[model samples]
Target: MPIVEINFDGLIGPSHNYAGLSFGNLAAMKNAGAVSQPRAAALQGIAKMRSNIALGLTQGMFLPHPRPNRAWLTQLSTDVDSASSELLANAMSASPMWAANAATVSPAPDTADGRCHLTVANLRTMPHRSHEWPNTLAQLRLAFGNEQHFAVHGPVPPAFGDEGAANHMRLTPSHEAPGLEVFVYGVAGGAFPARQHVEAFRAIARVHRLNPERTLFAAQSEEAIAAGAFHNDVVAVANGPVLFAHEQAFADKAALLDTCTRLVPGFEYVEVPAAEVPLTDAISSYLFNGQLVTLPGGEMALIVPSEARETASVWAWLQRHLAGNGAIRRVEVVDVRQSMANGGGPACLRLRVACDPATVDPRFLVDDAKLDRMAEVVASHWPEEIAVADLGRSSLIEAVESARAQMLDLLDLTQLASG
Candidate 1:
């Protein structure tokens, strides 16, 4: 089987808004109460997928989870009108737009059964995101349902918080070959919550039936977490055989890289020193949150947010690195300011799964024509703007529901409306 990495991005929801629900995310907190342009945000996300396709990458999509989550609100014994402000915000949260937290995927080559495995993330640390697993699991099951090629598992117990692939990385000679899987977890001493628990990943490894010798675990720097690097991908990302990361991304960087060198053949790294790009600058600009992808011509490119280009240190580093013949040969800047304000970038908006595309559900895949049609639905039905205070309005709720329904209908995925 020819395995390729498919990026499944979550479509920005019609309810996209800035509620500042993420405690450790500086961008989310700083931009709280700001009016959001759902239509523009969704279109921007669609354009990003289109760009990846143009680059000869296989693109997939996961629909927005049903928002104004009445089911969750009902569990709390209140409806939108009667719920507390925090509860209401949690219910209306559009944070699911960050698909990087959707699951932890182990490609077929790395698993004992020779079948790809994905475990839906529990996201138990944040109340707003804690309820995401069921809907996400439904979508994962639908997309990777071919039993001969894939195995999808439910989330680990909520006792162990797991933020998913945002905190995971894999290094291999090729997507089809067995790879060394690195699970980066965090310790909780930081002022901010460390979302990915060590035990959570251990549970996933066992469930996935991965080889013990092939799996490695590392601790995310407490400094990175306190500086608003809530997930490892915020400061580090790996593609093929190259690991691109900030100097301060891991607690024991030397040992981790040493282990990686021993386990992964031809392992390479581009470590950005903190002296050059301060951790604060890194988190704020989301320099590493961009997708590090292998292009069709066998060169690697860093797909970064436009903010990275604006940040002097980040842009300078990229230019210097590219000029020096680093593993990242090119930097492709994209506009994801809408997602950036909510503390996500190109990498955050996608979940990377290495598998044979033919084994995956076609409805979850996209072409230029499919994306064009999706963009039309977003323009026609998505709300133009959503003020933070307007989250409770019955009109906004109905509009959000109607817009997502239209998207589902357009994709012939109406079955997910109830998921």
Candidate 2:
């Protein structure tokens, strides 16, 4: 009954981060220090609105609790917010088509299991929402048909940042074109040791054909009501190193690195405490191309474009401990500081869509030249097109939804009968 089978593969979706192929060291250093006149001038408007702009920009996707909120902090975060917003806008305006977004999914070799995803947040926000999820998922949906027999992981109930936690959702598609099988989890509560959270995520891994005993890499956040949630399904691996245990409230720097004892082969990262690893020094990013997009919840492959990529580091304590893994993509580029400051590198800006169970998908297995050419070809047809990587999620969804509708109309049932 399913077009694709579930494999114990992992997540297949787009994400945005603060690391990627950088513009170069000189450019990065030039911009690294305090804001320049023009840059500062641009930030003035944002700063006036809020005082603490830097923190907002540097803050990880999710941070832990107990940090005092000061009036100055708001101002600095606002600056970060303003800068991030402008960068996201630039990325979105760069895309030529709505293909940037696709159904968010993970690979599952079991039956038709997969991950289902749809984000429920103001993606327009600077570092937090910004263009990462929206742009990544948008193009993916476009490359792969939207609403397919795949999985979707998105916002749950109570909204993110609500009740000191965010709600996440996973959908299993029985059908595409509004595709869904079962909403693996329509409403999930807290992430730490909560049965509700475990059951919800476990449902997705089961779809992916993953053994309940296997370990899973999960994105963590101290502010997350869902801390330690991933441990329920399988072992959880996190990328960001530095997390504040729910019990610790602050953060245990030593414990952060201790968690890094486990790392997947081919990808190696040992946890290092924040005091030891400077956040601003710079880090390298990786690329993911032609990789199979696996969905754990939905039990099917969601549509992914040709590639996806990312780069990340665990600078904050809260994010590191809670999130088990950063992103795992092939390392293509390195040290993209300018790009990183804008809040994401190559991998951070992509969304994957494909149901291929193999390590590689033939259609997606092209070299970088071909991938660029594909974007070029698509761009030629539409002048408004920017890099598929640039567009935001809302714009991406609008594009893919249109594509599916058009594809349905153009296919002629009569032609099949004649052939």
Candidate 3:
């Protein structure tokens, strides 16, 4: 089978808001209580998918998980009407928009069974994101249901926190070749929570049947995590044979790269020094959170948020990087400020699955026409803005529900509404 990388982005949900639910994320906390533009946010996400398609990359999408999750509220033994402010915010969270946290996927070439395996993330570290696994699992099953080519597993036990692909990186010579899977875990992050537990990723490797020799586990630097690089993706990203990261991203950066150089053929790295681009600048601008992708012509490009361009240090380093003869040849800037304000950038908005697109559900795959249709629905139905205090309004709840239903109906994915 010919394998290609498909970036499955989660459509920004209609209930998208900034209640500052994520503690370790500086952007989220900085923008707390701010009004959010759901319509603009969803449209921005669609535009991003369109840009990837224009670049000759395969693009897929995961619908927003049902919001105002009444089921989760009921699980807490309280109705939305009577729930505390915190409980209501948790139930109404749209954190699922960051699809990178949705799951960890090991491509067929890297797994023991020669079939792609996906494990839904428990996201157990945070209250608002903890209830996402069940719905995410349902979507994964539907999209990659071909048992002969794909194996979808439920979340590992909640005792250990797992933030999914955000903390995972796979390095390969080619998309079809077996790869070196790197799982980055955090032990301490000052006052912040370390979301990816070591044991959780170990369990995923076992479940995916990945070879221990080909799998590497690395510890995220406590400084990086304390600087608000909550997930590894915020400080490092790997594509094909190249690993682009901050010099301070890992606790043992030299050792990690040494192992990759030995295990991964033609492994190359571009490490930005903290002196050039301070860790604070990297985290605030989300420079490392950008997607480092191999374009169709075999040249590599970094897809970054516009914020990266606006940051002086980040932009300066990127220009110098482009001027040099580096493996990453180009930089593509995109507008995802809405997601950025909520602590997700271009990379955080996507989950990369390397597989033959034909084996996946066609409904999840997209073209320009599909993007056009989805954008229309978002513009027509999604809320203009959501104020923090408006979360409890009956009118806003109805609007949010109706907007998602219309999107589901348009995509012929109403089945997900009930999941």
Candidate 4:
């Protein structure tokens, strides 16, 4: 029996398998320009264990050190609070609009009609993290005029069993994601940080994590997904074979395929056959969202596939998919490639946020606080560059369109309700 894996929806935000978000667009919180370039006078030994993709993510700040001078930040500051603030401040400064949009409830940029928020009356809370964050959840409610619901994944205990205080949360859809999902699982105890899930998501996470000691445990780490969750799972199911970064499990690759199938058998696996294939230093060199993306600059480029080389298979899949739908009438499979001997894939580059599914759940309909809560998330992420002016315009467009689509679906489901 040929081994294959399945791609399933109903996992939360962004589509990668793990996360630490509890509400709205968290990625928009950080400075997009922060990691545009490295500050090292001499670009030597920049990466070690991971590729340039890993280092460039500003992970250097969180990873303890980027240079041989590991204690550089601590030496510059007296307290971790100052260091953390400075790090964020540094990222914010790189962008022209960090301090300007400091407050969450600050009306969307360039709008001067009342509070510019939905629940101007009273908003709510948003999940917080040491990572670069934006306005509070309360402010987000103000942005959407209290109409949309926002939710993020809270950190949780690692499936592998980290001691305490989950550094991250795998924000998978308890219901369904609109776009993509990446999954990683590991042991309860590992060299990695522990899990930390907020008040939400306490119930379903443990089963999501198994023993970190074995290959199955290897499947239990963090996940990251991009884009929103579609109401329809039928759209979410992938129609191709599973591709891996490397045969990470080596001889156990067979069992890994079996495990993926058991997880979602409707999907299949297609491995790039191993013929004593020499390993590359890249963390992962797979296709994403129909693009051949890579991070080539790494401490050890030879060991990892950090070089942003274009893969032809990825281009083919993308051309077929993109030409089928979307606004592009004509398809151009231009090889927009770059290199960052980086740590991981686009999956690792992103984080998860809201993942509300278009389901007939009474909970979704009854929750009066849903949309209002969502607006709060919107507020938290709008940095100065993406002003409330522009953000609100696009958001309104999306909301109106979403509501219209949902209404049509409701008309169909009315038959089911009536039955």
Each model's total of backbone clashes: 0, 104, 0, 104
Q: Which ten residues in a row have the lowest lDDT in candidate 4?
A: 6-15
What local lDDT does model 3 show for residue 282?
95
lDDT of 4 by residue, 1-419 (tens): 11111111110110011122223222233222222221110011122212322323111111111111113334455332344433322222211011111111111111122111111101112212222122222222221223323222222223322211111211111212111122232222232321322221222222223222211222322222112100001011122223333333232446645654554423344332223221221122333222111122311111212232344443343355456552222222211111121112222221112222221123222121432332233233212122122212335334323432332243232221110
Q: What are the TM-scores, per candidate, against the unseen true structure?
A: 0.99, 0.33, 0.99, 0.31
Name model 4 segments beyond 4 Å from true.
Answer: 1-153, 157-183, 186-245, 249-251, 274-277, 281-306, 310-345, 351-419
What is the descending lDDT order?
Answer: 3, 1, 2, 4
Cand. 2 Cα-lDDT: 0.26
lDDT of 3 by residue, 127-200 (tens): 99999999999999999999999999999999999999999999999999889999999999999989999999
Off by over 4 Å in 3: none
Question: Root-mean-square deviation of each candidate, in angstroms?
Answer: 0.7, 16.4, 0.6, 18.6
Error of 2 at 19 (Å): 18
User: The CA-based lDDT of model 3 is what?
Assistant: 0.95
Which candidate do you rate higher for TM-score, 2 or 4?
Answer: 2
lDDT of each: 0.94, 0.26, 0.95, 0.23
